[model samples]
Target chain A: MSQQETVLFDAQGPKARRRTMIGTVIGALFLLALAVVVVLRLAGQNQFSMELWGPLLNPGNENFELVWGVIGEGIVNTIKAALVAMTLSVVIGTLIAVARLSLGRYARIPLIGFVEVFRGLPVVVLVYLSVRALPDVGIDLRGWPGGQVFWGLIIGLTAYNMVIFAEVVRAGVASLPRGQREAALATGLTNGQAMRLILLPQAFRVMLPAIISQLVVVLKDTSLVVFVANFDELLSQGESIIRNLGNPIQTFTVIALLYIAINYTLGRLAQWVQARQARGSTAKATGGDDLVPVRDGA
Target chain B: MSPVIENLDLYVDGFLTSLSIIVVAMIGSLLLGTLIAAFRVSPVPPLRAFGTFWVSTFRNTPLSVVLFFCAFGLPELGINRTFYFFGVLGLILYTSAFVCEAIRSGINSVSAGQAEAARSIGLNFSQSLRFVVLPQALRTVVPPLGSVIIAMFKNSAVVGAFGVGGDLWSTGQTLTSARGYETLPIFIGVAIGFLLITLPAGAVLQVIERKVAIAR
Candidate 1:
């Protein structure tokens, strides 16, 4: 059978088209069903009253002051925690990844094990453990007024982000050809010199997307700290508002939208970086495969 | 200090609950993920789009939002308090989205020639997918899927936010608040328990990956 004949004869033709049409129809119906259920439930509870949204949306409403105040504070705390954690995690992750990729087996084994365990543990558990233990060792983390919850949050976020960044960096480094390192060594570069000058820079470019992605993960994971430190990140702030309003639907919906905004912005930033790199590569005369030197050793 | 016998039992009970949730959710996510993966790779454009939307939405949205929406938001809409059930349901839905993408990527990694060969031998699309594509894809996917499962188990801690009647973190919270025993030991215990579950699975996944590489 010819290529054209196969294309025509295979069910990838009309059947696929028909299935697509059906799938769209079903999707529309599903969304409609969901909307109807939501509307009906709201109607039964009279939650659809314009009164609630009015105050919430109104710039001048008194509750708006508290709501936005809490949100603003939460935003500040979230950013602080995420920034601290991101810095710590990246630094620690680099060290750990280096340790894992080290020539010594004994060193590699423990580092690898630590990464696995930390990555596998939940953020809440880490936060809880940190908060519970730090004070007992005379650290008195929580006793310093506002500093207690901040430290706990930082520790928890760092623990998980460390693992993620380690994996990302390791994979990035491994993707580099061994010859790059070998070339560096041929120039009389030391092991550390080769890694820093030849490998780490290139690895970072490759791992840029993964690192950006882990940032979002770390951001959301910050919410789990409410379990331990009880600090008011966006989620906790929303929860507190809901506790006062006795309306989980509206408050949580607001919170969800806020998260979507933050996460979506970061996602777009990552895509932009990726696209720039893609265009840069394509624009250059080196073509695809000939670009980016790969070293098989270093 | 010697471990307290009574506290040990409580910890064991918490571990059991956590383990059961993890097991059930893992199975559910795998099945859900597979079906979604199939849909995603279908020749049908709409199916592919729908699958993409599902995965992207779940992946981007916070797991806490999903848990809270199901547990609290649904109940407001006449879904009664089936906390335990809904808790697992939410986790499965969230985790499966990630799993589906991983599986889809694995499927795409398989050479197109293999599928063509399977079809040339008179196998249908489903048969080719099952015998030729899936087996290969699954072998490549085990390591990532193991990571996803482990992540899901860790994420179930979010279910504690639902004020669920029982679970490890919730029980720990209850005990800590009531007994005022140092929350440190219990927290450490839970972390260790979580590590115990995921580390072995991760090791097994690596072993399998190595075996597959050797076989190849």
Candidate 2:
């Protein structure tokens, strides 16, 4: 008797394809329905006006330039915040990751606790707390006259990113072959020396993709600062425009497009980095699965 | 005012409001996010493309932008733009993108072998996914999804700026606008409420994470 060969259905088989078709059909219908309702409501209210669209579309008027300028400021603010946050998150995250992996329970426990607490907290709450706490501590971020809100947001963002980056950092370090450490010890290098010269650099390179992905996250997170800070980002700027123009749908659509542009660009960048890393690792490929998502359930 | 003592009632009220919005938004965003995630990972190319587009658009766009669109912009379109509805919608949409990515990543983590085994045993597509695949994927996704939920709870505070009623942040703003009360107490109270909820959640996720580690 001959045994029948069984192929993997989990690897995008015919059945999964059928489910995908059904799901897509249902999802498309739902989204189409929602979009139609929104459009009908706008059309009914006469919000789809030529007058509103004309000014925003032309960009010829002085007011249009001013709005564009405000938008420019928002762009600058968003980039600035994301860059600063990303740098801080990487540096602080590295320190925390090291601490968590320390041999001493004293070093390990506190850092682990810190990571969990911040990782668990909502970004908004941290921002609110920062707003209330920073001024009381007598250290004001004067450049942003918006006061507590800006600092609160920055600090909160840093705290959470620290938690996320730390784990990725730690995991990268932990995954290094134990033989490397043994080889380093055999070469007469101290624990710290081996880590600094051998382990840390490799771990950082290995973890760079994950770190960059977090940068995208930090960029997206910058928009959350709009409500708390008087300083306007893309979302805030869009809101202000809609308020002036009274055309929420168009303004929102514009905002969504801007977000899509920036985030999509970042996503592409992350993909590029991943591809490059994959190519680099191909020569030295082993059993390691670097791209696996962290598990949630036991 | 006696520092903390004089503002006890106000603090309690503010805490309650923050807690309520966080809870509601967390649940709503999770359910919405999971569905979107399922769509994104669906096998159909167009469906996958659409899901990817939706997630990317929402994830890339700031939550406040989404909220403002719903709040002020919707009103312009004669949608009434109530605080509750707008806030919930914004959170769900914004968080759903992240949730989808997390869930898809989780689903991807499961080896194709498990699904193959289910199929070899004569299980159908939905049946294999429901029984064998999703169970494994859920385990991997739950902790990260929990973090996303906590993040949603925090982001709901933005709706306060739109003058959304009932939320803790809004209630604090209402109090401040009416009385010349120092902004400190109200914000502190709100922050405390968030801490109370998030702190425990963080611990719970840690526990889940450990269990996952052990299981693997």
List, in the given order, the native-contact fraction of each candidate: 0.46, 0.53
Question: What's the C-alpha lDDT at position B57 in model 2?
Answer: 78
Per residue, candidate 1 scores C-alpha lDDT tens digits across B1-216 of 223245777767777887888889889999999988867766545566678778777776678777877887777778886788888888888888888977875776576677778888999867877787778877866666666776787787777645554667776777667877666765666677667777787778778778775243
Write candidate 1's Cα lDDT for A62-93 as tens digits.
Answer: 68888878878877777777878888999998
Worst 10 residues of 1 chain A by lDDT: A289-298
Candidate no. 2 TM-score: 0.83
RMSD each, Å = 5.2, 5.0
- The parts of candidate 1 lying over 4 Å away from their true place are A1-23, A58-62, A142-146, A275-298, B1-6, B42-49, B111-122, B211-216
Q: How high is each candidate's TM-score?
A: 0.86, 0.83
Rate residue A11 of model 2 by lDDT. Answer: 48
Over B114-188, each residue of candidate 2 has an lDDT whose tens digit, in order, gives 878888899987798899887888888876777676666666666655566766676666665576556676666
